[model samples]
Target: MKSALYLFLLLLALQVQGQHGSKLNAQQQEQKSPHSPEDQSQAEGENSPHIKTAPSNYDFAFRFYKHVREEVGNSNIFFSPLSISTAFAMLSLGARSNTLDQLHKGLAFNLTELEEQEIHEGFQRVLQLVNDPHREVQLSMGNALFIDDRLKLLQKFLDDVTNFYYSEAISSNFQNSPEAIKEINNYIETKTHSKIAGLLKSLDPETVMVLVNYIFFKGYWEKPFNNLSTRDDDFFLDAKNSVKVKMMHQSKPFNIHRDEKISCWVVEIPYKGNAVALFVLPDEGTMKQVEDALLKETVSNWMHSFTKRKIHLDLPKFSISGSYDVKSLFEKMGVTDVFSDHADLSGMAENALLKVSKAIHKAMVDVSENGTEAAAATVMEAVPMSAEFPPPPFIRFNRPILMIIVDKVTQSILFIGKIVNPAAEED
Candidate 1:
């Protein structure tokens, strides 16, 4: 399966704090509520036999990441592939023919042999598993559909989003209500724990619908970093440029692998639950080559090649953020139909000719002595927008590095970006 357009239009922000950093965002502290539709049987339809053994498809994600990285160039990049994929998957349920084909191929799904309902069920299963309240991880995902009250949307599409994707739908008169922007922004803030704001500065009067999705995560390292050991150090941005940064130090048994072929080091840092942050540090001046060789199979091989060993590690305690407008990026990915008049979103409404007009994405990541906290939000305006290995013997992340945040259960890449400079400001 291919990755979708705007699949990685991400905003990644990292915040740095000394021994202690800002507490988890407030939205995470609230009581957990089940967002699944009230109809239990409908929501829990027989688990797809395929979902249990099906591949999570990380190849599509890696390919998408490489493309966006090349486009953004030299800047710190971070985004949640799973979040973008989920949003597009929800949108695809209402897609038809060529439009649907583009989405499926772009997202890297081979559902030719699978029933359409089965695909939705697979996503539903994964969503529930990842968001299960019992899990130790704090992952909060919220999706909203803002539609102009004048249009009548199909009940099936609404039901699928709610039951399968756990999204909430809202109605608004974008053409007449000046407050529509504020309302949507408020929802984005609340969903992303206020990490993202102003996703929609203004709404087009002709817009018939807008789709928004946000994901927030906070988790302590299975083995927390010693805040007292954190100290200021030099982080090399290149051969000649460097910046002083607070580096978090830790010594423990960790999963690691060294790929001599690519001249890089891969390490896995486990979050409190099944989630983990995989770091790939290429030998000096080899970031591009390492990235060029990245793939789902390569990553899987590296992950399985890990041998636990006691190694000292120094990682900068820095926060970073990134944002992007990815219409052009999507076009590059061959996802053009949805943005042009040729778009076919007939599944959403009876006679409405709906196509995306704008797509905006924002993300933030904060790694401190305590653990790691990150959040991402994507807004597809209808007015519309479119949207490990280890080793650790004195390994210090003093240079540019690639990072991938993943959920092991689904093997989904929640966030992927390259950090060239810890002190670099958010875009």
Candidate 2:
């Protein structure tokens, strides 16, 4: 869900349009409410014209995802779209500059300006990553003050997402006044390719919030099991009863790497796009040591230090979904407000009455012969995390484990998950 006030205001903002870097020609086009957020901004600094994001957008997004990977203990998780978008939006706010400027810092704008070829290549890279055959994955571009430019896709993405969420608040079915909720839900159902947003009904709907959903998957072995080879295998889950699971086996020599702290390998499965799933199996009896050693620096270093090797591989075809409340996440990431009525979305509309209310995210993923598949959706908790607890552990696996799904070109996470029980398919 979105902040009730921001949602309503953005709805009006979309219907009421204007060219980039220009006024809305308040005469006959759109009606203006005196108490509206936009109205207040007009009275205050009407001279300041321009929508701004922040310089730290990319770092914020990447760091947040990194946090999720390292902090969340539950296996098989999908990243939420709405949550990531909101993170960008919030990051933009603290950027102290325009969204593009913030993005420049991330994409190395200063180093290699945005050229037409770069845009084409960037989109191509993104598309290739999303359309990879091995793992089902998705990538979205969003923006702010969307006018044709180098960052149009990014801005449009956010604009599209804003409209998507605003529709939810005005739509979902509720007790006495469900008309608005119904209207919005029906409209959104048709927009997101009928993939998500079943209905817009929740406990609280008047504050800042976000909703996220996703899908993910890593493909089966190039040579699938004959059912005979997939006999009950003893999966070391704790010291208790060893769960029986069908194990997929492979003997192809692939890229394998290991150190005193960690073990990793890449297995390529023949598919439409250059598809491959990389697994990082921590050394036996050192799962805790590996996790404890985690840091953005270490992960970045590991990714940069890749070498191919030949080794037998054993993995399992599996799928999973993961969900989390991002209130605390935002707090940890240093984003407050949007949660409180004090939230100032005055740039979009009037009155300082708006507040971020609730956030919920859910993601789904699957892996099989047909190619890997995944989808994710996130809803921001206009408020903050309800519980005051530290984030839980990520995972502790001794045997083979799934690590991440990457769009080799852009190196973005289309889907990130782990399967503790390949057969169970639990989140």
Candidate 3:
């Protein structure tokens, strides 16, 4: 019931947040763009089960996120207690369809009562709003959920939250590094459509080394699947059930790894920035059955002891691209109390009092035998991740806020970051 309520609120938020679910722009609707029952994009085949509310799939994704968050040292110092408690509340309230409205009320209450210095400074204490441990942690979780199909909406949310804290907390130190400033600026525009503008001072570009980390995966398949032999095959859902799916097939030499303890295979595909998709297909015959039987113990044993072999490989030549507001996404994962102001945030900055502003994420994955292409980017620092103030004092950030990231070793940023902050930045 709670899950259903969350889904409803999600749909409602989409509508209220300007997602018309139509290609027709707002201005176009005013002019009354022609509407036809059939659409050109629909000239394709049936819509498959891609975005269904599957618990296992969702859990897997979030687990991957949690693991990454924990991997980023002192993860506990990221959010203040207030934010932690608020996150808890959000999780509980998410079960209710009217949760979004309630969250607004709760956030307003916190903003009025709490106080913070840097919002998230140096990542230290858990005493006040500005430096609260849990609050910043919740905010930093945004580190992952930044990719989104709707980059504009994602930018708006990003801008709102960053401005919330940095409005007064942030300081300027351009002498840190000029090349760093240029690097950061270039990356911001490239990643976020030029909406984000300033994230560093020329003086301290090396600061990036302090707060940044990266992951690059690349791979090549030993056996390539042939397009000619590829056909729609019956993929068993359960030993007793099955569904017909387009499965690519080919006979070639592949370093196929298998494990008897946990039946599966290791297939890899490399991409531009050393990114790769390592697929593990189970031999349980039925996908649903295999998934149901999956456990960490089995997975570990498979990864540790799987034997390599040469055999014919069958796969699906397909792509799945998706994006979501991860802030709300994690709310469903049971961390609700952190968004509140009545909480603590003394760890990140000089003062205490802070909350998450947004959490945006996007991903695209394509697979085949000869090779595969896949990319995943997530940013959840905020969804509705902003600290509300009465009309916000002086919007010194008249110019677009920028974010850039580069691998000094590679002289390139495989990924860039951004936050729109305001509608004005859209220009």
Candidate 4:
């Protein structure tokens, strides 16, 4: 269960807001807090030779992705299911009875197969592994609970969140002070490296607690694209429409596979560590078919089929950002009780009638010849093949294509989205 939440946190790739240059030095990196008992236990679990993940875990992730895709429509879509689910998991920590059951079912957790304790433990282990300072992946997760000072929260709930999720607790005057809104937004901005702004516009007069989760990831490609080769090129939006884009060119060996069943080409580009960006390009008009057939099994098969091959790749340099209110999305997924008056969050406070009033998410990603510079925060050169050999197969992402940044070892998707028109001015 905890593994799922860790995967939930991995969905940090949603398009947030601003575009910033990632230029921080290693010395300037923020240090994690001292380890607790939870962290130690998580470490022990993570050191195992093989990582075990239940199939339902990926099913839950892909199901959530499908819902987001449907809601966002055909335009360019970017969201971190990990970010959304992490928030829900934290909320579920304080939920009880029917409310708890609804959250588990909505998030696609198999209640009969996994107990509650196991779920939380899985999350702890994943979090600890991802937050390891020694890892080369540039990733960080932050959670904050803004509560109305008038209502005293349960101490045990606060402690559990602190120990298990490493969330920061803050007290605020939601009803009296409008500054609470600013404070909350400011905190989110800092945590997300200013990628997301105005996360909380206002607060309800009776809002007992507001929970927020923010994750930022930045990594450079193991083999970077040559910046000099980047030039203006046409990106086909459709059969008759196209836009000029700054396409980055490279000719090198990449982990690629051709799926005849879906008529699509799948490729994996490794990052500095266990993370990688998987790009799926469908044949001409077969994008819809590929999307419809998307599943954990499909991705697993692609991974297994991947073989190092020489190819000339031309990918456009693009940056995308998006905002969403996922309350309706969750409602459509049959998670309505948590937002309605009947919400049972009594475990959070005594004699409470608590329910989530808002569910907001924002994400952004930028891909260039250098690598990636998103909300989190760059350079590499691909070695060209020998001139004596015949020209390698060229793969130009001239149209809409699916992209996912995943942790290769755990096979958890951190961010998933599509670049319909990389050069399109609008999101």
Candidate 5:
């Protein structure tokens, strides 16, 4: 008997705050700072999964972003590449032969360099880092499997997913499609704290199983923007099209870098926890050049080249969401067998042939003056600073720009996208 497995990946990053920082320069801060991400990875040794998987994850992020950019054109772009990669990695547990090879290759993992066990362990470590209790950020990620009542999964596969991915399996009556859909959607909504709802519009009655993954993240600014300082400002979409947005203002010493190669200004904003947001504003008409140069090495160089400097910053408050049917995109990346009948997911169950029928990913992010409502109540600590020697440079993000949210501990990019129109919730 042949049965179809549906994969649904939902990611929500709500109430993500913009930059806030003390007045101290970068050099003075460097003396008090801990090891860099690269140093920490090296200290953790080569056996660490965090060290082994970061490059693969980053490569996958860039590849996915390029594809999504091409597909969405000039619309507001946002997505959690980590979320999609995690789901696909989980699915690879049940895959075999070419399907498994394709999954690993699509994820930018080299089988010769990293064994499958090491890759899975790397993801496990990344998940642990993301949910670390010591961090001030609130992040929770989990996976679930909804199995039809009639199907029996392999005990080894079940145990592996539970042990490595921390996934939960629940039996569902898929013969009743509406009930199954409601159950899945409700679970996702609860997991994301109502940030996501009704994720499943419809489900096939023939589906034997559904694999789900969801992530919710909320982080506070170390120095939050004052609500009184935000005002309506113009956000230029182009030379002629402009929209009014509530632009947040701040004048503080921040890590800033100018990339002449791409003709862009890069600003790094720190969160209260182990995360930072990078904003890249391109020269007047050099967005295409910047976009084309979004390689991992370019980002690494920008991070290393930053110098602490005072700047008059003006950034808009925006909320954006994106939903993608990435099955075709995955096929475009050479992961085709899983969605077709050629899929050999025999490792998942006995006496059954399984193939993925659908792959859907949806993500939403909200950037505001003080992050999430829960984080808004916390008071920011006051820090003393030396006087500026020179008048600070003024930087305004009035035009379209690129944004990336990264976790410092694992050096993983949590979310990456661009905002062309702040007013539009969806494009």
Candidate 6:
């Protein structure tokens, strides 16, 4: 039997309006509180090894975001950095020499500070944490290696991915591009519960192996907005242009902070479980300032500075997806050797020279009054809210906004992107 490990993240909210009837239960509310004693101890303790690599992952997240932003321009942006990182990490198992070093560096890992073993162990810990069955959220992550039946992979490489990364290896005939593409896409769709489909439009016939990583997350807001409050509003694209969108409204107490340095309002909206969504609304013309300041320390400060306040929040009811051929992007990030003929993937298989030919990534997110539903997949072919006090600030996401979803347990960022226009579907 092929065991299905569902690994993805989604945020879902239902239609409601002008009512507090959908408030979180006691347990959910407790999970929303920041800096809990247990959370603090876990961060300072040895139990949470994934914390060590979080900084690296975040660094990669921001860098990748900048690259994608530059490529897509002002279009709506959404992609799972976690899925991308995980796929590359699994690929690193087969990487050697400069190829391996480039992978580590591109992932923003400091070899001097953390050993290679520690890095893999950290990811292992993260996989365990997110897949915890008892957690209220439905979140899962998985990896798969579809290898050409003609090539023989190293036993050690196979063992490492299975034991450390929870990956499954299946024999594939890449020469049959259509069948291979169909099989891989079907597997990903099933894993993400159909949130992501046709992740690979086509596969290279010369491709000896294709590595894939996927994540599916579904989380409901602790405080859902009432559907009655949703109405048409303008979402400004810039100083000159705007688009009409169905804006969801809610007024309630929320964890909010103002970062004067970046000139943005950071609001933390809790999900019904260990995840939380962060909406960063930059003041007019300061979007670039806030984006440039995206760093581990910057986000940490925002999380620590949050204060409960009642405010009226107006957010767009939007759904967006982003797809990219990350081969060029990875090269720009200094991961060149892996894609070139000078590659050293000898650790993967004996007597065969292997290199990643193409790497693709796709992600989708749906946000409504109910919550959020998001799913993402990566194939290496090779590869908010509100609230108020004193009439509380009426913060409306009527312009470009940044969104970040995080898992409190591991402090791992599940997804991050910008919504320049709610009406745009893809970039």
**Alpha carbon lDDT of each predicted model:** 0.70, 0.38, 0.28, 0.71, 0.84, 0.77
Tens digits of lDDT, candidate 2, 70-117? 667644445533234433333333222233343334322342534423
- The alpha-carbon lDDT assigned to residue 223 of candidate 4 equals 68
In order, what is each prediction's RMSD in angstroms?
Answer: 10.3, 17.6, 24.1, 6.1, 4.9, 8.6
- Residue-by-residue lDDT tens digits, candidate 4, 360-386: 777888786553333222244445445
Superposition error at 225 for model 1 (Å): 1.1
Rank ordering of all candidates by TM-score, starting from the highest: 5, 6, 4, 1, 2, 3
Q: What is the lDDT of candidate 1?
A: 0.70
TM-score of each: 0.84, 0.55, 0.35, 0.85, 0.90, 0.87
lDDT of 1 by residue, 84-203 (tens): 667777888788989888877777777765666766776776676666665556676657788777778888888888988887778877766468778877777776667777766666
Reference-based TM-score, model 3: 0.35
Candidate 1 local lDDT, residue 75? 78
Could you arrange the candidates by lDDT from highest to lowest?
5, 6, 4, 1, 2, 3
- Judged by TM-score relative to the true structure, which candidate is superior, 2 or 3? 2
Instruction: Indicate the worst ten consecutive residues by lDDT in candidate 6.
Output: 374-383
Report the number of the highest-lDDT candidate.
Answer: 5
How much does candidate 6 score in TM-score?
0.87
Residue 402's lDDT within candidate 3 is 16
lDDT of 3 by residue, 1-427 (tens): 0000001011000000111222333333354313211121123223211111112222342243343333432111011112222222222221222333344333322323222222121111111122222110111111111211211222333342343322111122333456544654444334333323353333322121211111111212222334445566654333454445456654333333444444444443222212223345544443324334444344334345544333445554433322344456445554343333332322222222333333333322223433211210121122254555432221111111111121111112122111111111111
| Candidate 6 CA-lDDT value | 0.77
Lowest-sum lDDT 10-residue window in model 4 = 1-10
